[model samples]
Target: MPKTYYGKYGIEVRTNEHNHKGQKAHVHVYIHGVEVGAFFLDGQLMVGNVKRKDRIAIEQLILSNRDEFQAMWDEFQKSAY
Candidate 1:
């Protein structure tokens, strides 16, 4: 997992590359080492639970840096192979 964004109050956004069979591009949101949510590049939540304020912050972060995050995901996929 690579740390992508660090925000106020210990919030973080990171990308995880699945090194095994059947994995898709996604990001993980964390607050103080605890995962709050996992979301796709398109800002769709895949799993985990997040508070409303945190959810909005995560979505906004993704939206603002969508292209960069997508590119990172692509690079990570290539590297995993």
Candidate 2:
């Protein structure tokens, strides 16, 4: 899974990577080693095992990492849109 620069909250920055199949191109976020949730490059909710606060934080993280996430998708999919 390719990782990406998500966001920074104080000293904490949300980061994620691509995982699984049967799903669209997206990233899974984690703090330390625990799985929080997932979100699509189109900015949709896809969190697997996260809380509401984490979901909110993930949204903010998405805005900041949107480009990186998109870049990852473009590179991974290798398709033009």
Candidate 3:
């Protein structure tokens, strides 16, 4: 698992193995331990996890700093897999 900050909010990246039978790759996001949503692992707009209060901020960060977040995710994957 890995975590990052967007202003005062927190975003987490994590995966659950065997969560649903034959589930494809995906990542989950939580806001201060609240399950916001899960996204397909492809890192595309087809998947999004933005809450009402933080949606705009999260979207901007995700779009603007994708590389940094992706790098963090890569390291987490290395540790997990």
Candidate 4:
């Protein structure tokens, strides 16, 4: 998994590329080591629980780092082969 940490939040791109059926580009979000949910590159939560404020913050963070995160996700997909 490729991961990036920001303060108390950890965002990761999981390596299970074959499991992404109908799913868009996303990252799994962890807060304080607990899995919160998976979020699309656009900052929409796919599944799991996240407080509104935290979700907003995460959205901003994702938007700010969208390019880098997207690149990591793309690389992970390629590595599935």
Candidate 5:
């Protein structure tokens, strides 16, 4: 997994090249090292729960770093073959 950390929050893009087939590009969120959930690049929560305020913050972070995240995802996908 490729991870980026922001203060107490962490974002990770898990490699799906050998498994998780059909899973969309997304990031797993963590707070204080605890997994919170997974979210799409658009900031939508794919699964799990988060406080409203935290969700908004997460959205902002994701949106601001969208390009970087997408690039990471693309690289990971390219290795699928």
Candidate 6:
């Protein structure tokens, strides 16, 4: 997993190739240690567990760095095998 960005409020965003079964290439957001949510690299929330107060910032973070995250995912997959 590569951390793509970090923000205030202890928010961190990361992308990983080895998510649970059935998950797509996605970004995971964490606050403290708990996973706040999982989102597609395109910035769409695949499953919303994100804290309400942090949703906007997280979304913006994803949207702003979608391409970089996607690239990281692609590279990770290529190197994985």
The candidate maximizing TM-score is: 5
lDDT of each: 0.65, 0.56, 0.54, 0.84, 0.86, 0.62
Give the range of the ten consecutive residues with the poorest summed lDDT in model 3.
15-24
lDDT of 4: 0.84
Residue 71 miss distance in model 1 (angstroms): 0.8
TM-score of each: 0.73, 0.60, 0.52, 0.87, 0.89, 0.69
Candidate 5 TM-score over all chains jointly: 0.89
Better of 2 and 4 by TM-score: 4
Q: What is the overall TM-score of model 4 with all chains considered together?
A: 0.87
Q: Give the lowest summed-lDDT range of ten residues in model 6.
A: 8-17
List of clashing residue pairs for candidate 3: none
**What digit string (tens of lDDT, one per residue) describes model 6 on residues 1-81?**
445446442323333335443446777777765676777766677775766668777778777877777776666655533
Error of 5 at 62 (Å): 0.5
Q: Output the number of the lDDT-best candidate.
A: 5
What TM-score would you give candidate 3 relative to the actual structure? Answer: 0.52
**Which rank order by lDDT, best down to worst?**
5, 4, 1, 6, 2, 3
| Local accuracy of candidate 2 as per-residue lDDT tens digits, 1-81 | 544434432212222332333346666667655555567765566656656776777777776777766666556554322
Each model's backbone clash number: 0, 1, 0, 0, 0, 0
Tens digit of per-residue lDDT, candidate 4, span 1-81: 667899999998776554464457888899988889989999898899999999999999899999988887767766644
Q: Per-residue error at 77 for model 3, in Å?
A: 2.9
After superposition, the stretches of candidate 3 with alpha carbons farther than 4 Å from their true spots are 15-27, 39-53
**After superposition on all CA atoms, what RMSD does each candidate show versus the true structure?**
3.0, 6.0, 4.5, 1.8, 1.7, 3.3
* Superposition TM-score, candidate 1 onto the true structure: 0.73
lDDT of 5 by residue, 11-80 (tens): 9987765437566778889999999998999999999999999999999999899899888887877674
